[model samples]
Target chain A: MYQFNLHAILGYFGQLPSSILVTLEITLIALGASTLLALPIAKARMSGSRVAALLARAYVELFRNIPLLVLLYVYYFGLAQSGLHLSNFWATILALTTNAAAYGSEIIRAGYSAVPTGQREAARSLGLRPAHIELFVVLPQVVRVILPPFANHCIGVLIGSSIAAVIGVADLSDWMLATGSEAFRYMESFLVAAVIYIGLCQGVAAAMAALDRRSRRGAY
Target chain B: MFATGSVWDYWRVFVNGLVLTVELSFIALVLGFVLGMVIGLGRTYGPHPVRLACLVFTESFRSIPPLLLFFGAFYGLSYTTGVTLSPFQASVIAMVLEASAFISEVVRAAFRSVDRGQWDAARALGLRFWPALRTIIGPQAIRVLIPPTIGVYVAVLKDSSFASIVGLVELTRAGLLVRETVGDSLTVFLLLSGIYFVINFTISSGALALERRFRFAH
Candidate 1:
């Protein structure tokens, strides 16, 4: 039986903190960018204009169907050939943002749909302006509806960011590869990385659940 | 600076890789369905230990990044067990494990979605457990089971691309190889993405049609 090597794995913990940050940074940036992009896409999808809705639908379908790793390679390597150079970090961010935005748009669109049309009409009849209705009447309910899936999406992004290591973005997966090779302890490093990943996923879940509860309680 | 026209020169290579990708995904989907069914049923109705084991298996596989799992299967297994898995074997194993985890959850939820009254009805009718499930409960749960199951298959198909990192010359890897020789990363990767999009889009559309066909008004 192969002996367990705790010492070699433990020795690599010093380098993990930064890689964890990189993973988080990638996840957060991508999440933010995707959320921003998703708003417009979702709006377009729900809008009255057929051309706009069709374009939005096409955007979501295109990005949703393509694999993230392939998207990353396109931005990281392929773009360079067209004289638009992107560092691995930016490339990863762009790919993840575009990919996640497709799903995010769907989530946001669902949230918007969940808000009954009667709610908007109710707001309008109250003599509220359109912007005020959107802000006070629509946004809050949509936020609540989207919270659970949005949390799940956040967790997905956290996990998906690991793909950044493919383009050598120095994230947690890259650290696992580096540590495994250097210490010749692939199993040990893999276990360590797996623990950190599971921990982060659970943490995101817990935090999101807490936020979801707070939003629910805050709602009337 | 674009050699987009030259990408089709390697159509044979792309076709080979595409075939491999479809074969890998189909095998994994079938095997994952089997394993996921077991785990899902076990989790829902088995004794305590079995349920716990099912939960742990599902959560761990779901929680960990799949690339990490692929690496563990490919490299960690050899290091610890002194047995080597070919890249294809390792990729299939990793994909099945991950896909089954997701599918098991779907299974458990779908099974649970069947009313408790349905089970009592089956027992009252003198139907035994397996017969009750296979005849009554299974049919009801299957509708809930299929659409998300197709979703999981698409996820598995997309994730199978990661198998390239393990040095499998699947579609994505084939594209990388072409890029290496063709020196047109833009054209090559675009071709790769387009092929993936076409396949995935078809599967999703077909799934939607299947779901509609299966729909019944309660």
Candidate 2:
């Protein structure tokens, strides 16, 4: 029978903070970049121009269909051959940001569709500029609709970031693999990593839930 | 600049890898659906304890990364139990376990979409529980079940790529092997991505069209 060894993994506890910080850094940057990209993709999809909408649809579909792992490889390895060398960290960010923006655009598009056309028309009649209309009129309503799914995607980026360890990014899962192999305590190391991930994910969910509640309260 | 000639030399390897990837995905999807049905039914109709158990199972699975499960299956299992799994077996077990947690929610939601009135009507007709579910409720619930289920399948397909990390020699791994031989990373990965895109896009678009058809039927 295999004995459980808590002490084996304890020595590596010092690496936990930096590992987590790397994961969070990847998650936050990717989330922000994806959200920014999503706005334009959603707008283009909702735009009157057929070519722009078609281009946007193609972008969403292409990225949505490909795996994050494959995309990461393309950025990390593929681009390096073409003479654009990126560090694993930045490559992971680019891959996650591009892959996630497709889903984010869909979520944002749904939020846009959820708001009535009459609202946009009304904003226009009030002589609000188109940019102001999107910002002031449509965005407020879209926020509540988009927040929960966006949070889920935020959590998704966090989870997806774990795969970055495959490409040699020193994130939480990378640390787990390193420590586990070094100590020959793969189970114990995994348990530690799992606990940290569950905690971080739950923290994100709770924060999103609080934001959701506060948004609803303003509506009431 | 795109070199198809060199990469094409490994066509047999890619084919073998593609077959294994599909085979892995199919087995996991079938087993996951069965497991999901049981958990989903229990969550939807069982007592409070059963419901709580199902909730906990799904939430815990969903919150953790699937990669961790892969590691747990591939490494942790052997470490703890002295029972080693082949990489393929480990991948299947890990994928099925995680996929079921997500699928169970889809099943529960699909079941719930059928109104309480339908249940009452079936009971009023003197049909038994399973009989009523098969004859009356199942048909209606299927409409809600299918499209999202396809979404899950696409996820499973995408995730099967992770098996390569565990040394399973699937499509992604095959691509890496070919890349090593050919020494052209851009061509190999782009080719892999394109193949994945074709399969995934076809399935998803089919699901969309089917969803539209169902909506029109309603």
Candidate 3:
């Protein structure tokens, strides 16, 4: 008969709270950094300036093609050898941010494209400042159009951050692995991790779904 | 990478690892596709209990992180059941299981996008359920499924790198091995990154071509 143990998991509840915080720290930083980078690249992709578009495309192509794990190694392991050593925490943030930016730019560009070109004409005819046109007219609609994919991007960022654990960053996955190895109760430790991930992801999905509906209902 | 041998020795090791990575990904994708179709069909058209089961399956798997799933499947299963899995087996199982969830979501969306009228009309024309799906709805759903399916494939390819963490000596692990001997982490990893980037770039470009083809056809 297979035996089950809850105590192994319950005992580690103490570490989990802080681990989740670290995970959130990485996730939020990456998301914010990526968004900062993504907006400009998305704009560049749509801009008629061929040079800007080419550079943006190059950035996306490079990051998109490389696996995140390889990027992690390059940032944490490779760059260190070259004498620009970042702590695992910063390295993870940088690697994940770069990756997230590439993907986010593509999604945001798609979102902008999905909007009808007539809207651009409307904004142009309004004689709005260029900045005002993007900030007020283009962005609001793009936000609605991109939210679903954006939510998926957030989830991907969350999952990809698990690689930070590989670099011994003490994030949720790292803590769980440590707990499992310490207790020799790997099953329980992993189950706790799985539960935490599920809860967080489901929470994101629910919040996104609600926002999606609310936005469609003219509550935005 | 040269562990007291020619540079070609380590290059051969990396090649072997890359081959294994490809094999594992191919198996996982094939299994995932079949499992996803089953879950998609069950969720969409099966009886009430089956649909509920499918929904639960897809959502739970989709929400969980692949790494967590990897650890859970690798250690948890053996801990509970006392049945051992090879590292490759465990990792591939984990990949297939989680990927099927995402793939099924893609399938479900694609299937849903097909008009309800088509389904009813197929039935009215005396087509049976499976035949109706195969003959009428399947082709249309394929269009919706293509981009996402390719996206998932690219994801799984990259994701297979995690198998290294679970002790599968795939490409990432091979690079790690090279670093251990050569003590030059950056150059070795940069090489691995370049190889992976090239392969993934090819995949994405192919997907773009396929999407363009679809657009031109339509």
* Per-residue lDDT of candidate 3, residues B57-111 (tens digit): 9988887777777787788787778999888988988989887998999999999
lDDT per model vs. reference: 0.92, 0.91, 0.87
Instruction: State which candidate, 2 or 3, has the greater TM-score.
Output: 2
Deviating ranges (above 4 Å) for candidate 3: A217-220, B1-9
Residue B58 CA error for candidate 3 (Å)?
1.5
- Candidate 2 Cα outliers beyond 4 Å, as residue runs: B1-5
The list of candidate 1 runs beyond 4 A from truth reads A218-220, B1-5
Q: What ordering of candidates by TM-score runs from best to worst?
A: 1, 2, 3
B64, model 1: CA deviation in Å?
Answer: 1.3
- How is the predicted docking of candidate 1 categorized under the CAPRI scheme? high
The Cα RMSD of model 2 versus the native structure comes to 2.1
User: How would the candidate models be sorted by DockQ, starting from the highest?
Assistant: 1, 2, 3
